[model samples]
Target: MSQDRTGAGLGVDRQREDCEALAARNGWQVVETYSDNDVSAYSGKLRKGYRRMLADLDEGRATIVIAWHTDRLHRSPTELEEYINLCEQRGVTTQTVQAGALDLATPGGRLVARMLGNVARHESEHKGERVARARMQKAKAGEWGGGIRPFGWGVPTGETTKKVDRRTGEETEVPVLDMDKGVPEEFAAIDTGHDILLAGGSLNSWVKWLADKGITSTQGNPIGTTEARDILLRPRNAGIAVYKGEEVGRGNWEAAVSEPKHRAVVAILKDPSRRTTPGSEPKWFGSLIYRCGRPGCTAYAYVTQSGGRRYPSYRCQTNHGGGRHAQKLDDYVQDVIVERLSRNDAQDLLLPGPGDVDVAALQAESEAIRRRLTDLAGLFGAGQITMAQFTEGSDTARAQLEGVNKQLGRAATQDPLVPLVGAPDVRKAWDAMELSQQRSVLRELLEVTLLPPRQGRMPDGGYFDYDAIQFRWLRGPEPYYAK
Candidate 1:
């Protein structure tokens, strides 16, 4: 076990040479070599090479195990105990090139190994604490502590530059910096994305334009709509320092976009009331919900403007026909839905049907599925599983987990209509409900349809009649005409 996880870029080759020479001096034929690159022994992360070497020892493939140092092999007492047990089960011995010999066959040798493992564990933990403290101090000072290079910033560079020694008159090596050229483009892209968003440009259009202009993400891939949106949403892009998710203070870099613009974009994305268009509802829920009911016209309506006034009306964008005022359609359908749900028979529809359901068991199964997905990701990281297998396994596990969760959410919801239906003032109870709540109840019961406007002078609620709207009830009854 010639494990050298770090400092490998500098002297891993040298370490291997040393191990081979030591084996030669001992007249031992080095049957095999095992190494884990950039892996940590004490971090509880899976080390594939280390696991393979252990498997070999257990299966009688190899009886002797050698390492660069004790810490390279085991820094955790729990892991050491398991290894010691395995060594005892099979007649095995351990040795290190640096620390000389370890006779694990004897009790004294086992005692020494335990002591060394404890010391190694202590050192690893102490080093982690010191590093964390140092990082916190740097963050508080607003100095860049160096992480994944920010999109609009330069990558850190280091070189051995000559620095003159004052007394000896000799030159010494000093590190220097050189920045990448894409930083300016990154800054420019932030401004472009901000302008595009405010001007009501589509995210897909902006993403395509950025790709055409050779603007890419920090990973060098053509930026996606979500990534472009994230760049604009980052408060750090506007020169604000954040720690643990909250803005701590001003940053040390120049502002990419004004603070106002950054906040505006965030607000627009996060607002619950915000729709696809600035002033209206999302297309999926607007008049499109009552899709154009004209004979042989299968297209949904898209909102359009005329004579400098916006109409919340549905007209087929594809066929460009079957337009109607959305308000009249919604009012006719929603009122009928409220009246239907107020009936006593609706209670059974809202209530969960009789079935053998164990909430705790379902919850446990969901949690187990989630853990399996995590294990699949770990296998992908260790290269034990292909990306295709991981993706297929993960998606299947997620879907099962989602189904379980939906069952749980449904089981947990109290029937809001129960008390409303029982109340004397049912209409008042319906009126008091929030618009979102009202919409949710309506959606649970019916699917609505809107007919084309009649060719005549406008009626009290425009040329469209109340009969233009239709509802296909999902529960309690068949299609209910509003009349």
Candidate 2:
């Protein structure tokens, strides 16, 4: 069996022809042909044709096996021993076009075959070492390792030229990866995905958006939620080089996302609390988003239709005896968002002025803090630091990062309502946004707290008390939702 296609895209056809001619010349009646093209025996990847040939021998269908070379027929010495055992059981001998015969019938012949296989195994090991070294050097130099095309990267358009081997005077082909180039569509998709994540959009929502935009993965299949998150979080998107699962350095290719955005997106995607339902969409505005203001509890509240309530109420999930009318709460929040966003002063109130925080400085600080956290974790993982030390170090680093992220957000990355700050028809624009986006806006601008029920019953016999639903402005102008 042969491995890999030729420069002309022909796979093992030449080797098969030579083998067939050798069989014909020897007057050997070939029962069946076995060819595993574009496959490698040295690498231990499954060779379908080779396995089938062994099966034929075991079942007494064929008595002799013929191939291109002994190295192609047998892999390591261990694999050769197994082949020899099977051959003796089946009373079979092997013939090769180059190495002549592999006589498993006698002891001396077996010794010679075993020695040759050991030699080949040694060569394969040395070759693997050299290849690994070369790949690591390439990665250090910011070159892409050849493989299936990575999403959000350009398709390779260049190939390696033939080189002459020094010892054998044979021409060999090398594969070259031209992934340093840029694809506009893919880069745009990466940017859009990062933006969606930063704006509090769910991973599932981004995947749906990918399908709606007809953007499949590099393999041309619909991107899954996990794959989408992985692609967006890949360090390559920020032009960071990686070798053997470790970041090496910067890549030669242009970054699809800013470094700060890349780090922030990574944090967002790794958040345990983030919603990850692939196709499910949020229905209510404040479900599980508004905090329970039950005096002492701070757990998120969910809308409940049970408990004999006529309407769904955003009830506390921690068995806290409190809930507010979901409809009335959502309506009040919606009006607040629409009115504030429609004002002429919304731009000055919502967005940063010219003398705002320094974006570059915060970005540098964020990177340094992340690096410290990574090193600290590595120390803890290596048993060089105590759990208390790691926890303290990690918490401090993360707290610093959190502050930097906030400043970075104010600098311009986190606000999704920049487009609506001074729009001519903010109400129309707000109404046009999807429910998830509206919730994101609400989450950004206001923090809703469902307070516990009052002692006396309402005069109108309603459970939702306007005074009980506390709305605190998190950003922009404060709306008059307070008592």
Candidate 3:
């Protein structure tokens, strides 16, 4: 029996013809033939002819099965195993044009079949890896790997190699003019191959253009507005590969459009208010500077306003058993905290001193991981190890690399701000920072506290005692005041 299919490959047709000729030469009678057209071998989920062949094998109608190669029989391992089992049970013989014959009844033949199947599996895996790596490399080089060229462009055909014309000094590549049919009288003489009508166009315009052209995608589906926009925005069209959030440029492939061109289109698609929003009202100095100090307090630090701006205070949201509230006005409390922080040697407590991170140690660790990876690759290439061994070693090296990379990143970040921390002008810098930046600096510096309102009457007849504030300074409680 011969299982030949259309849309498989020219190889399959040639192999089928060879099989018939070989059968004639060997004087083997042709028992049956099966054909399946326009079927995808990648997805073996459905094939009417294949299903019928299996049924024929089960009923002993077919004793022999032949194809171009083992992959033609089955692509997946599980499906291949099932076919082998079926052949074994039915005592059917299997043959291939490229891989030769197999008799399931004989142990030696079965071993050869299994080996060949394993080889095919390995070949498929290797091919997939090669293709993926090639795509990645191409993307990094900034080439359009593969896909329909975007609007305003066309794939260069024969004799259209040169992008620019020598005589006219104009681009000679095929340009996508108005996607719409029925050329206007004015644009009739315009060379579309050189001029794209939709220049600096929006996505909506592209959508309308596609609709007017009556052009569908390769999938034969009508182009939608979203699909049109996606096609325009695709980085692949610009000769760049986007992998893991990184864009790599391919060198050899032509970009259908330029990056700035696509960015302009994207700008039109974005909402107008994307960059404009009302600013937030300024809060007290330490309004959100500290997390709640109370062990069980789930609430965060917040500012409250009362009496039409007469009072602005920072307090823990969960201060009084969830529902109870305490109000501390901004001017009254902030002035006191500022005075206390200014009078004390707060800079010593606020700035992180030297010896926070060792740069040399981090660099050494990073170099060590790179050395280990190199060593592992060398070992694998020297035939001293298997793929499994190499993978294990590489994984460990990568983890170590990640750890050192994080440390290096942190060290690099610290280098910029470390010197400013202990400078004499640190207080001036802190006061000059925006409110949000000031809050960030304070949160990094201090752990703050809110003391309860004091009860009446001091021995000295002073309304409030500054020393009795009872605030615990966790770090340097530096207070910044406006000049």
Tens digits of per-residue lDDT for model 3, 81-147? 7887899899888777767777767778767766776776777678778978888666555444554
Give the whole-model CA lDDT for all candidates, comma-separated: 0.66, 0.77, 0.52
TM-score of each: 0.55, 0.73, 0.42
lDDT of 2 at 299: 93
lDDT of 2 by residue, 321-405 (tens): 6447788888887887788777677775565542577778876776687668768968998999999999999899888877876
TM-score of 1: 0.55
Clashes of each: 0, 1, 11
For model 1, how many clashes? 0
Of 1 and 3, the candidate ahead on TM-score is 1
What's the true lDDT of residue 310 in model 3? 50
The collision pairs in model 2 are 4-38
On TM-score, the candidate that comes out on top is 2
Error of 3 at 220 (Å): 9.6
Candidate 3's TM-score: 0.42
lDDT of 2 at 372: 89
lDDT string for model 1 (196-232, tens) is 5543344555676698898877668888766776777
How should the candidates be ordered by lDDT, best one leading?
Answer: 2, 1, 3
